[model samples]
Target: MSATTATARPTRNIESLTERAAALLGGTPDDETLRRYLNGLSGVDAVGLEARAADLGTRSIKTTSKVWALDKIVELIDLTTLEGADTPGKVRSLVAKALNPDASDQSCPRVAAVCVYGDMVPIAIEALGSAHGDPDDGGVSVAAVATAFPSGRASLAVKLADTADAVSNGADEIDMVIDRGAFLSGRYGVVFEQITQVKAACVRADGTSASLKVILETGELNTYDNIKRASWLAILAGGDFIKTSTGKVQPAATLPVTLLMLEVVRDWYRATGEKIGVKPAGGIRTSKDAIKHVVTVAETAGEEWLQPHLFRFGASSLLNDVLRQRQKISTGHYTGADYVTID
Candidate 1:
């Protein structure tokens, strides 16, 4: 699609999310469709999907588009640091890096947000400073991974408190994991309500709700059919974005899985007149891989998803790689990883 077409796209047709849910549920508050709508869905054609994603991965992006993609990639990074070794000092460094990814080039854009464990939210918030303030001057939001993080095994109350603690600590966004066990065991209703409850718990210090990105952990789900169902379920349950994996799981964030996610988001926008964001975390490391994912978003979901608000990459090393590519593009030589600051 042309850049003009992507940028000039009009606002999506949307009413309140509640109304959208009601419509999806066919106006019945206790409708069985809420529980069984995703059941019996056709299984994914894995071979075909992988083949298609492979074909798209070969697209040659050059010069202007390459530069644009690199800049955009910088903005889409989540700049994550979720290790057990995380410290206040580590979080501060990550926040600084997120606010200014490249000190040498003033044109380089800041990252979208800094993702960390719930306890580190305060450190990141303090380092970011007035997150709701002016963006051009310097504004980077903090995203806390809540709901038992990589696994959603805790009790409902615990999960709710986990979400509440992060928001109270000044998180602007919440990335939550779904109950994969419930989803796999045919308890769709349980999974659906879990997401709604977590979303409700994202209310910020000022009472405004934080944006919620539902992590489906597509790696565990194992099929495009499951990914598709999970994506729709998250959207119907008030998720602002549908994320791929937690990056802790094996085989996290493959292109075929991400392609299905983009398709689901695009189709959902067509159905509900509201756009939901897509984030593919885990296993995406290089600038080429990053741009390939960008291509998938543009082609599958339309250029509207290309914006930072609608797209993100949950990664730790992705920022450095993009920066290195930026340096290469400018000076006509590759700078080793030693040159870029590690996040």
Candidate 2:
């Protein structure tokens, strides 16, 4: 099947956060306006959401289709390593893996991107060398985690600087954690401004902006309602993607949560004629789990989202399992534990 491209909307034309917020809220971009708009959103039906996700998971794919799904999952993965102990060698190794996930089978598709820390962006770029460009063009992208990733417990100045540093260092994408404290405390305007500012900081010297993925860390949000609200807030504030977690928290990237996020992306596209991406990061560690997500994306958001630009899996170990599955399908036998690399 050919990949479908979604219509691109230029967020840079909006000029300022205030204007962006005003365009969404229909009034001044103040706390009151943000609260009113967000609060007016419909509440989530937890039972219905879970039931739909579960039903989608039970749908089986044919063996021939499974081949396509496995390769597509590989193409959609943001091969990630965000450890504090990550070194230049580790980044280089990861870039190599991203470029060639299965050395034995050159037919294996490359992953979407290699996610790393802000400080490691240059290392990832240097490692990628000629193979780093656009994921849509079969080249791996360098995605950096910034804005006080995971905890997000820092001042706005610090977060903006973090974003700027990453983009300046040649990160093709920025995964930023939102201030959950502010969002939960009803400081919706604060979260909105932060995302918009971070988006601004993503602008590079060449006049192009790095893709900004706003991490909601839904485990901390506590309810499906907040997840839906946060997803909308991220889109309204110019986030290119709404990510589920920073991979440090428990209960990250549940199917129900991902389905809800996809619903939001679908809704946004329906209302605005622009497409937004979704990334379900953390705890997705197997081919079965990855294929389930692929199904959910297809059913809820339409097959157009099957493209790398619209959907992604933020994972590390998930690739090995997928490579194993691919080998099993090709040779009619499962490979040993050493078939895939540990990294």
lDDT of all predictions, in order shown?
0.79, 0.86
TM-score of candidate 1 against the unseen true structure: 0.88
Off by over 4 Å in 1: 1-19, 27-32, 40-43, 130-138, 334-343
**Tens-digit lDDT string for candidate 1 (1-343):** 1111111212222235557677767753232666556664566788988998999988876566778889988888889999999999999999888877889998998887888999998787777665432222345667889999888899999999999988777676789999999888767778877887788787544445677889999989867888888888888888888999899997898899899889888888787677888999999998888988998999899987877678999999988888988887789553432232211
* Index of the highest-lDDT prediction: 2
TM values, all candidates: 0.88, 0.93
Backbone clashes under 3 angstroms, per model: 0, 0
Quote the positional error of residue 179 for candidate 2 in Å.
0.3
Model 2 accuracy (lDDT, Cα): 0.86
State the lDDT of candidate 2 residue by residue for 1-343, as single tens digits: 1001111223333376457568779997668988899999999999999999999988777777778899999999999999989999999999999999999999999999999998998888877777777787787888899998889999999999999998887877889999999999999989988988899898766566788899999999999999999999998888889999998998899999999999999998898778899999999998888888999999989999998778999998999999988988789553333232211
